[model samples]
Target: MSPAQAMERSYATLKQMLREGAFAPGTRLEAIRLADELGVSMTPVRDVLHRLAGERLVEANSREGFHVPRFTEAMLRDLYEWNSALLIMAARTKRPGEEEKPIAPLWEVPAGADRIAALFARIAAAAPNHEIGDAIAAANDRLHPFRIVEQRILERVEGELEQLITRGSDQPHAIRRYHLRRMRAVPDLLRERGEA
Candidate 1:
């Protein structure tokens, strides 16, 4: 593979690991180690780390290198709120002169963290503006770890997500409730993850 291909591969691999809770919060990411693991050079690994940092999926420090973000309750709450608002805004938006269509009711869209994120992205894509979709994606990347933990802690997560997907723009209240439920569970989530 070419140098750019190597970097892109490294980026995708590391990003998936970070998003899937492969690293514990605040765990330092040593580029050399990752480079060895990914069979790439240190340069590409370092570059990938910086890229993930830009997405807020990883944190970078001059002295300490890169590490997973240690999410605080407030940060988690804000992300949840931001995600909720984005979905709600998307629900209320319409493509100019485009006829309204129900959100594709793909009820078999898997389950757990990926399910929720995928469903939300689908909702965001309904908006007239592309920026909303991009913003929601960023939020989803940052929130993915939390959602993984939440799947284990929260009750009836799949049911809530199904409601959100099935009702789509017809029930903005469902979107709010879905996020609010996670927001309220932040304490328990943090405690469960030993971050509280």
Candidate 2:
């Protein structure tokens, strides 16, 4: 395959491994070893590590190599708070007197983070401002990794999302509460494993 394809392959493989918790947080990654593990050369692994560094998922230093940053309790809570604010902003940006599209009832919706994300995406898209929708979409992608770890939180959020979508209401408190609740569990899990 071409060099670009090799890089893409390495990037995807490494991203999946990281998301699946293959390496504990705070572990330093070696490009040569990773290349051997992924059946690629060091070139693609280096490129992929730099890309992951850009996403803040991994840290890179020219002299010291790559390190996976640990997610702190405060850091997780802050991310949730910021995401909650973005969701509220998306709601507030809606034009006045705009009629909301009908949404499915709570019982009809499926459980899972993807569903919860779709619900938020729909709510954000309802805003007349295109920028609001795009911002929400980007944040949702960044927050995707947390979904599997926080299934309980997502389950609670589904009902709140339904209320927001159907009634055209801004339920920032509900969103923030849902996030903070999940924040409690993540820190414990990460800390117990010495990953935080």
Candidate 3:
């Protein structure tokens, strides 16, 4: 593979691993070790880390290298609220001559975090503003880890996601309630992850 391909491979791998919680929050990511594990050179690994850091999926410190960000309760709450705001804005903002699209049936979507993420993405895509979609996508990446924790700790996660998918992008109230449930579950999610 070419150098660019190698770097893209490293970036995609690291991004997927981070979303899947392969590295715990606050764990330092060593480029040398990751390069060895990824079967790529350290240069690509370093570049990938910097790119992820720019997206806020990885935290970087010049002295300490890169680490997965450890979320405080307040930080998580704010992120959830911010995501909620983005989704609500998307729901309310429709482009001229844009028609509403029907979401896939709940059964078609995988349960848990996947369902939640997919629904949110569709809602973001429905918005007229591409920036809102991009923001929601970033928020999805940031919240992916916590969403996995919520699957283990929070009750009715699947049902809640089903409601959001069913409600579609027209109801800002439903979007607010969906995120509010997640915000309320922050404590449980933290406790389950032993982060509290």
Model 1: per-residue lDDT, tens digit, 1-196? 7889999999999999988888888899999999999998999989899988898888999998898888789988999999999989987784553235554554566678888887888777778899999999999998888888998898788788657854534557889889899899999988876677
Question: How many pairs of residues collide in each model?
Answer: 0, 0, 0
Q: Which of the two, 2 or 3, has more TM-score?
A: 3
Work out the TM-score per prediction: 0.92, 0.71, 0.92
* Model 2 weakest 10-residue run by lDDT: 98-107
User: lDDT score of model 1?
Assistant: 0.84
Per-residue alpha-carbon lDDT of candidate 3 for residues 138-195, written as tens digits (9 for 90 to 100): 9999999888888777778777765665543547877788788878888887777657
Q: Return the candidate ranking by TM-score, descending.
A: 3, 1, 2
Off by over 4 Å in 1: 96-105, 166-169
Better of 2 and 3 by lDDT: 3
